[model samples]
Target: MSYIPPHKRQLKDPVSPSPFPDSLATKVMKNTDFKSSSVKVNIAYSRDAIFKWFLIGSKGISDEVPPSIKLVPVSSDSSDSRYGEKSFVLMNTNVEKENVIAEESEEEERTRWMLIAEKVEKDLVVAYEQAKKGMQDHHLSDNAKLRLVARFGKILFRRIHAGPVTEYWQAKSSNRTFCTDVPTSFIQNIKSKAIPSHEFCIDLEKEVYVVQISHYTRPHSTIICKCTVKEDGSLSMYKAELNPLRHLVVDVSCIDKNLDMRFMLAGKRKMFTLTEKERSNIQRMLDSVTVDSTVKGGLTWPHGKPPSENGYTIFEVCHVRATTYKNKTLRLRVRETNGYSERFGTWEVERGVTLILQDINTKLQEQNIERGCVLEMLRDALGTIWDFLHCDASLT
Candidate 1:
């Protein structure tokens, strides 16, 4: 009778119950064509609402939705029901593929660095061999020899700074040792509380002497002073070299006791007695050491382990060939850890001191050589050249 909509007419007959049961009603609603509805609403929103309702009914309704279930908008076309599901599957597949690509790129980068490091190591070894041969050649002038040695030093310096090739030599010579230790003590002061500084000198001659002094000293500190024996037989200083020690590889022994201490600097042995204070200090450092026999240095520790109030010591035995120092024979050395000391103090210090010593030693040796004697000149020249080139610069 009245101009009522078809939806309103259906609702007006509230007194009549539906013939379908609850489960059947849900199935019929799911199968219903939303395009046939008289009410106009967002098609996508409506589909999402229906899906959410079905999920709630199956899983039991709650105030908050479950985390695992996600609602997404669907297309207006009722026939394409599986479109949203296909899109979600494609998105997941794309993410997995992207992750795989990223992983592959990272692996490739690491492999590239490894290859670069290997090349650097090979180049260093070749350069060293060439320099060694060139220095030995009598035909090559002093300038030519210096240039060759300098080129080798430059290569070594550059490789050391290069991030990829640092510490390459340690891995190559992990098993090599160039050190020998003999149990011996100083002749005098076998059991003395007070240790004198002059006792640490090994006299090469009255004019030329090799002395063991503290590694840390002022740049202008006088190491070797030229003195004249006066008429009264008193030594009078005339000339002095502010910085005399260069390219010196020191070997330390008698660590167990301070009664008689020994050190080998530039292949010359010096002996002395450590004072009570020095002995106690060294003893404290050596107490809490953790030893590893497998490593080249036979010592391992956490990187940048700071010194404690009690003191800290890391002992190592190193081979001369494995070190930057160009000593002829295989020998073992022990020394105190310095600022450059990393996990292995002996290895790190040996490598680090090379550049510093070379920069100074090359200049000093060139100035000190006399012009006349050919054999003596060659000997001195070869010795300095060997020190420059005989370094473990492998990058493996």
Candidate 2:
């Protein structure tokens, strides 16, 4: 008998109609172990219909293989030259786990960034929806709605570009345009929360002349006490009181060589820079006023005290002794040390002082006392008294 390999074995006078060799039955039963005979069949120059059917049959058989078997692609140029013909490479069962884990981590990072971008876009859509509903509830007409929406779109554009990632925020405040056409949804990928919000006064008015020390402009203080003359032949004193002095800009244009100063006061959702003449007058008023060194906070006694031969005097109350007087009206001892010695004069703060202090506390809270500069705190303290009373006010 002639010798024959197990895979090439054939039978004559077959008992079954099926043409599949007997060895193929054993190969299919133990699917984990594949033989060369299973893959070495002639596939070149096959008919189109036959090749299609062959692929369909192969797919069904491949399902029996383990899922962990990776089908990595082989370089076509290298494989064709080295192996005559090759397409995919079967990854080794014992391949390192670290490489697979690293690849999985990289894919996860890409997915996370995509998710963040999608979330920002969704938030922008929700904001617009809310605005639309609000306008509808207000019974805005169709034309009004269109105009408001157009304006709101501009606000949204500035808001989106205000993010830390974009360079648009670096533009000067005045130069910023309200007619921008950028859409909020386009900023989906930006980290908007990183931008800082600038703070300014709420009720700040312009052309209000007040005094401030010229630390940079001049060695001496100048008080700007210009008054606005009314049509009724009455004079209205320029009031810079109640303005947050932290955002105040003095002499930005550098116009005055001696003591040029400017005040950046707030308006409705905006700010107004004072004129050069207005700033100069305010600086003169600030320079004229003098306070004692012992006082952490003080202001001129505005209600009852008259201006003396020296200047407008500043006073501060000792809160510890405010209610010591048995009378319903308390004689609160106040320190009068503007120009005189610490105990040179005795000033009284009555029930009116209580009201004044209450108002001061409120204004201080609004200005955020902890973060206030010395000049700003002094401005608020002096302003609280200045606006409350109008006696012997002569910083001019």
* Candidate 1 lDDT, 1-396, residue by residue in tens: 222211111110000011112233355444434343222211111111111111111112222323332212112221111111111000011234334434554334333323322222223233333443443453423323221121110100001121121132112211111111111121112112111211222212222111111212222232222333344423343432222121111111111111111111121111123345644543333333334435443333345352232232322222122222222221112222212223222232121111112322233235333323423322343333222222211110
Residue-by-residue lDDT tens digits, candidate 2, 1-396:
332211122111100011111223234323312112211211111011000000001011121323333333334332311113322322324345335434554334333322322212222223324434443565532322110000000100111123231122122220111111112221111112101111111222222212221222322222222334345422244533211111111111100010111111111111123456655544343343333224322323223342222232222122211211111211111111112212224322211121112222233223223423423433443332222121211111
Q: How well does candidate 1 match the true structure, expressed as C-alpha RMSD?
A: 35.9
RMSD of each: 35.9, 39.2
Global lDDT of each candidate: 0.23, 0.22
Could you tell me the lDDT of residue 140 within candidate 1? Answer: 29
| Candidate 2 global lDDT | 0.22
Candidate 1: stretches off by over 4 Å: 1-244, 247-274, 295-297, 301-340, 343-371, 374-376, 379-396
* Span of ten consecutive residues with least summed lDDT in model 2: 49-58
Q: Which stretches of candidate 2 lie over 4 Å from their true place?
A: 1-271, 299-396
Question: TM per model?
Answer: 0.21, 0.14
